[model samples]
Target chain A: MTTETLTPEDERRFLDEILRRELTPSRSIAALLAGVLVVLLCVYFLLETILALFRLPGWLIDPDEALNWVAGLPGTGPGPVLALGGAVLAMVGFFFLVSALMPGRRARHSLPHPVLAVVVDDEVVASALARRARLAANVSPAQVMVTVARAQVLVNVRPTSGLRVTDDAVERAVTEELDAMGLSPRPSVTVHLASTGVVGA
Target chain B: MNGTPRGLNRFITGLLGLLLLLLGLGILLVSLVPPVAQAWRDFAAPLVRGLHGAYEATPLPAGSSWLYVVVAVVLLSVILLTIRWIAGQGQGRASLLVERPDHSATDGEVTISGNVAEQLLRAALSGRGDLLGLHVVTYQYRGITALRVRLFPRKGASPQKLVQDVESLLEGLDLMVGHHTPVLVHLGAGTRAMFTREERVR
Candidate 1:
């Protein structure tokens, strides 16, 4: 609810440095499944109607008749068989989609890499900033599990904290850290600002 | 739309019953036509009677593989029951999805103070659309610093639309900054925000 005025360039620079987590297998599956389902549903209904108009099912003799027609394959008609195969494939695809999706990772389960975290002197505010960054990164407080020692800060992030989100602000925080060292002697802060590495492998 | 599972089952059942009734009526209506009607009168009820008799007179007993038969039946039934469930899951969680990920922005907008302000300001500028002109309402001057962000509605946007957009953006930001892992990072924090502003120049 506060307003800290910003210059255009700092925002740009920080955005440039931002990183994002990748999609979880589960969520990606769920989303793709949903899209696929929509498409399949439409195609299925349309094709069913078209097939009916052509009387394809009727033209294909019953299994008993088909066997009598030529080679004896019981209860099989090419048109109907193709339709059955398509249906089975659709079902399998749907199953795989649901199985692979992980809603947790897709929904609310990503955090910035702990690598971005730094250990600062106990008196330094960098430690606190890192803590907030962890929180602001939505690293579950339980997951972050912060600790402090003699002039030191430690952070532990959960593995599920990967997947893309709006990382602009977090990157901004990093840019701020880079600038804090005054972008001086080789920009140690900015160089280190790219700590947005993956966590827990 | 937010019906409970039990309620949904009941609704679907009722819908199916209504559909069956309509279908039956439609068949009866068709049977009333001249040629179709004549045929229906001669055979429809008789066929129905035949179906009733044929239904139980022939038991589909599997030879020695009755256990396999039972298992197959059970599996089929389970698949039938769960099929709709799987289909429903595939249904939208849909509509529009906005993604904002930073936890800092979760409070609205991220504010910066002291030396970090300039860097943070740069990142904020990278925002798209209405995201551009975010005002960090406060910054840490001295002592303990806190960050807050204000989200603005896009031009002609509704409150619902704006909230959804902002929340999703936050979600996206959170995803972008964090890593994929089980054990957490940012562990062991030592400072709490003290009410006293170390330096409040404005």
Candidate 2:
């Protein structure tokens, strides 16, 4: 293998670039929209309180009064307002649950770490982590997800006897499959040499 | 419904506005006609308020006729929850949109999909001389009417020789089964490897 190795300097620069890429536009947009919704909701509630306290004729200040006050407001029937409000509330609740529970925050930003877990047969490695490092290990990452983006897998390879877990073999197997499909950056599923079982990284 | 977040959100905001307009118009129309049956104030007013609250999904504050606390709660809850969820999913899940002509000028099109680069880069980084220095990309090019022989080097391989090899590789495939498009093999870019200029049919 006489191939010239890319200098350590090059490697460092590349890794740094990865971090910057993680803060993608999609994340920003989502955050902004969420903030706007919350603010608008709060504003509405505050106004209702003030108006009610002063006893501003609630009937005169009906939905009609609110609409005319705004610029170029469309006069839609009541149906749409109810439906949209309900849907937004429901979606928010679901989002809150999943975000709170999921452990890996890497995917939360722009770190496209597509992960797959091939669980091996033993509990030895998982048990050890639980006992020593208090790293709650799952026998499975629950489910293995293969995304279109580049995802590197962290595997616990406890291959016993005669099986040489060379990086090339593993890399080859995964890359070949991805290539034939016209996918790139071929995913590198990391292999963790372990004693008993395997889990996701 | 599958509209981008921007479009979807705007549509929603528009809906709220529409509701306001209708409410306003309804009031103006009803006020135009005299208060039906002796200005029924107390009983009917409360009922209308209740119905409007349910209809708008914005529960006006208790004993308050203004659109205040209730609107805030609904909007705030939805925004925070939605944004937080989005924050979890990472940013920009939207597909990269490319504006390309329907008909490509190049013979056959070349497309490199997601995550494929990871593998190629890994191979390039592998320090394996034989793996083409990792930056070599393989693509199929078909052009107007013909066949030619050429060879090509692997990523790190000598380009002149690679072109020759590439030609032979194509010839073996017998892609020229008919009097048709030209088959050209050449290396594409973003290649970290050093290679001579592209070699083609002599």
Could you give the DockQ of candidate 2? 0.03
- Candidate 2 is graded, for docking, as incorrect
Shift of residue B184 alpha carbon in model 1, Å: 18
Q: Residue-wise lDDT of candidate 1 within B1-202, one digit each (tens)?
A: 1111322333333343344344444343433334544554455556545644653454444332223244445544544554554454322221111222346634553332322332444364465342224433222221112222333323211222233444444444436533211111111112322222221121
Per-candidate local distance difference test: 0.34, 0.34
Model 1 TM-score relative to the real fold: 0.21
Alpha carbon lDDT at B123, candidate 2:
36
The candidate that wins on DockQ is 2
Candidate 2: Cα lDDT at A65: 55
Q: How does residue A41 of candidate 1 score in lDDT?
A: 47
**Most TM-score-accurate candidate:** 2
Worst 10 residues of 2 chain A by lDDT: A113-122
DockQ-derived CAPRI band for the predicted complex in model 1:
incorrect
lDDT of 1 at A97: 32
Candidate 2: regions farther than 4 A off: A1-26, A59-91, A97-201, B1-202
